[model samples]
Target chain A: MKQVLPKADTERAIDSVFAAARGRMPGAGLVPQIRARAFEVYERTGLPHRGMEDWKYTDLRALIGEVLPLAPRPNAEALVRAKVSAEQVSADQAVKLVLVDGVFAPELSDLGRLENEVVVRSLREVLENSATEAIAGLVLSTTNDSAISLNAAMATDGLVITVADGNAVKRPIQIVHVATGLSVSTFTRSYLQLGKGAHAAIVESFVPAEGASGYQANDAIIALVGDEASLSHIRVAADASDAVNISSAIIAVGARAKLDLFSMTCSGSISRYQGFITLAGEGTKLSANGVNLIRDKLRADTTIVVDHAGPHCTSREKFRAVVDDCGRSVFQGRIVVRPAARKTDATLTTRALLLSDQAEADNKPELKILADDVTCGHGATSGALDDTLVFYLRARGLSEKDAQMLLIKAFFGESIEEITSEKLRDFVTAQAEHWLQAGR
Target chain B: MALLEIRDLRVGVEDREVIRGLDLNVNAGEVHAIMGPNGSGKSTLSHVIAGKPGYEITGGQILFRGENLLRMEPNERAAKGVFLAFQYPIEIPGVTTMNFLRAALNAQRKARDQQEFSTPEFLKRVRDVADSLNIPQDMLKRGVNVGFSGGEKKRNEILQMALFEPSLCILDEIDSGLDIDALRIVASGINALRSPKRAMIVITHYRRLLDHIEPEIVHVMSKGRVMKSGGKELALELEACGYAQFEDAA
Candidate 1:
């Protein structure tokens, strides 16, 4: 017996991604079997285009010109050494979760049981031995994006972190995924499971090894917050000059659960980072923030889709982007409120600062609410820095460069200061200050 | 004997001269008021003295403490005992008043070979200053000049002056938007900082502020230069009738 999946836009988007992949190689037997199955599902629906309300500004077609291969794993050792921030992890320290050629590197992982309330290990271990069905049932390899779909097909190892019920972990677990070695397109995945009433914080940092770039790294992550559970998650992307990252995050919040997610994207050649959040249970709350500081010709496209599925859920999102040179920043955020999800309160705001005349900011905020009792709104604004502010700081004894640095810092402060850890806060602040001081 | 001496000063903005051949000298601890009509180059003199950008020094020599101020950067001039209380303070969003002030004070302190104050110590000192001025404790926590009332801006100027404590303070239109009570408090704040080693230049269009600040000498500026110099009584006389004489001269 087979189950029938609903004919939703999400399903169509997934189908289109498969079609894009299936046409790349006409294979025989097993290759076509897998490709056909994926393509059939994709044929029923296509990837969301700009016409779609959720994908109004982000034109995936423009970015998906050619399909990348999912072969040879990334060089884990080289990437780990180059991309890792010396400030964050000591030369020899850090519970590193290396993804060599897109495969999990257990030899580099450092994790231990804390108070017997949480378990941290590689995804391969959980896939082989974890008894809980939630861990297995929660993993979805099929996504609307072809790159994500490829990642789903090729995901062999990832980070598997679980928080037990009624347990609060004070120490922040760091997950560092490096792409190095034989650098063909790498498909990496991260699966995070949270138990009821469990509280924890995690920082997912991604960087490419010395030879990292021009290759695609399609990655997916799932974070399940159980009832009364809390989570503070941050995702940092500091890739090399030629790397392209297409990362996705799917979060399901249980009743009365709280989730705070801060995403910092500073350096990447071309990154299409997407986040999908589902308010699955009532009384769930979330504060999602995004900050990106891009210079040169790098491109960072951030798209977020939040679904208000349950009643009495509150979700707020704030995104700020600072673009300079010829870099382009794109933001497409959508909030969907189902009829059953009444009393849902949500707001999305995207603000971009264009430093140069050539720099461009594309922002699209959408709202689809069938519930009359729901409160959902979104706004987007893009502008250059105020000359008055620059002059004002200059008059206060700051040089033109120093004054611009201060103004940029202030502009990006709303998002950076959202990190709860003072140490981490200072670390990111220092990174931003360095970028400013370098005259970027 | 002179704290700040301007010799044959000529300042211009965008190739247009604003301060032409202006001369002024203020001895230590002296309060000089530069009173003029709206376009008489009052603010230009303050900017020229503080080394603010956009104003080209076509011809002038500004000597402060026996050093050429025109050769110094804005912050350098600020560290060299020169302060300018802006007529309209810029609103710096996300930068708290305390943080900016602390950074400024530390930058000045470093230039002066002094140790920087720790966060707690700095907070204590600021709290004490805020207490003296009856300012709300949380006001310093807010973004600089953001959403502040006009009078509050003037008070914040005084607050910055107190924090920096420069030797020569040039306040441009500090009394513009202040109320009588605020003016009195601001005047007191300035008077409290007055010492034999400090000099102040107060710019105002009305005599009401002079009544509170009590300047020793007055310079009546017409067009781009000082037309006459008189005792403090000139402010009262100008208040009684008007600056008709000066306007006619211009």
Candidate 2:
């Protein structure tokens, strides 16, 4: 006889939340069925645990002892708090889309200037109208990870952006998720589609309102780049100090398409960023990189899976982490080349700088190649800053603290330079410097 | 009082004594040279003076301008006008040479309670010094010592020495990898910074560098201690015959 174990507290809580929120969840036709199927998967698997291979370093079952209740709809007070927090993370000269407590706030968003070249619709409206095939296929068909499943079952509202064929959006579109409630959870899902020959850039920022802490944020983005199109996506996770943030990105590149993705993580007590990218068409190019600054007993993990399903594709992944004062950082990268992906060129490299004796860093790189004609390589390193370098800087009249900060900045600067937009690069660099300045 | 003083300097690394009871002194406006073979503690002496970590100071007293220099941190010593030109300058990728120089200069100035240099002022100062040392503007734009040739690295040391205007300059094997042309250029840069209020302690294994920058006093070291002391003529003699006599004496 098979033994049946009791569910964890978080699993039960999540089950109850799903039972209560199933009917209220937006979407018409098969959307409700899809949501129920997703929740069933989560219930069967429970929260991701160390027993699973993918979640070896990040065990949500053990880390998240209890799950908080879903955040309520944002009231007027919450709107004001969201505005204050959104202003701190919003980029200059970019179209802003604001989401308060996982619910899209149209009043706080500025999409009027982009109405012509870009079509913007609320996910809730799209789901309610039953015109959700695109979103459903994008979110449900990509991966079966329990976190993604849980997000699909609970997502309240997000943006659906599409660029017309051959159109070029000059300014970047910024998505700002502001958490204004403490000790609650919020879920959001967004989708972006670029038509053939279109070019655009997107920036996603996750921040917390002043005085907000101990919150949980689950967000996901599904992006598609059409043939001959180019897209640049930058995500910044700067949540509250004690918050738990889990975000995922699913991206697909079409024939001859180019995608550049970069993410920076500097806040939150516990955070994990999962990226699933696929080369869906021939001759696609992808550049994915990330930087993590973990300090003060915090834990941050970045896992990326790149699938080269088409021939003559290229992918490069570079990640850097600076861990200090008992902080832990994890980087797991996997590259898969199908049999048809001949002439595929892929490489991954991750490095971590540990500042204290108690700091920890785990780097795992995996390559699964089924093609005979492929060039693939990966390298990972974890260690403290070079003593000689520190001594040299100190000998040059810089204090010990200043010397370390400069070296740390230099460590992250390499990956930040991959950003094509000079303004965005500068903005990211300044934010990194600000994080370093706010010492542990 | 002497500008720099050392008494009974005994240094060790991992329980191995490297400098045993060494004594040295230098007054302002003087150039002193310490020449030695490999493992003779010449470089160790320079490192000890610069306050590099990992070397245990078993017994020593280093004084600069009537103050106990050993009590200060490396940066504090740097701010107080003590500079050591490394034998091998570190290569720091992703940090531009211009930014590094600015940070170093401003840090020292801030420690001394002086105003930090404005962008234009800093640029002008760096340009003047770099021009004198034959360093191109493009090199300044690149990472410090990244892909720099041996000559360029030595010349960069001289450029920094000129910029900081330190009172006590310790050149630790600055001529190790330079050709005769590079030696001349670097030596000329060093000569340009010579002032009556400043002093230099040049450490080398060969006498070729002394030909360009003459020193008033030369000390021959062997087995972690000074075996003999003499004038400029001693360097010429040592060049004629190697440190065989000094090693035998030790």
Q: What C-alpha lDDT values do all the predictions have?
A: 0.75, 0.90
Docking model 1 quality class: acceptable
Q: Candidate 2 DockQ score? A: 0.82
Worst 10 residues of 2 chain A by lDDT: A134-143
Instruction: Write model 2 residue lDDT over B125-191, tens digit each, in one string.
Output: 9999999999999999999899999999988888888888899999999998999999999999988
Summarize candidate 1's per-residue lDDT along A1-440 as a digit string, tens digits.
85543545444443454444443332223433443554544444343355555454555544544445554543444545544432244222224455655666665555442346667666656555652444454554455654455554445567777787888877666676676633345656677778899988777777665555566666889888999999988777877766777788888889999998888778777777888888899999988888887889888888888889999999999899999999888888888998889899999999999999999888888898888877788888989988777765655556667677778899888778877777666656776676666655
lDDT: worst 10-residue window of model 1 chain A? A85-94
Instruction: Give per-candidate clash totals.
Output: 13, 0
Task: State TM-scores per candidate.
Answer: 0.87, 0.96
**Cα displacement (Å) at residue A323, model 1:** 1.6
Candidate 1: which stretches are off by over 4 Å? Answer: A1-96, A113-115, A125-137, A141-143, A437-440, B8-17, B56-61, B113-125
Chain A, candidate 1, TM-score of 0.83
TM-score of chain A of each: 0.83, 0.97
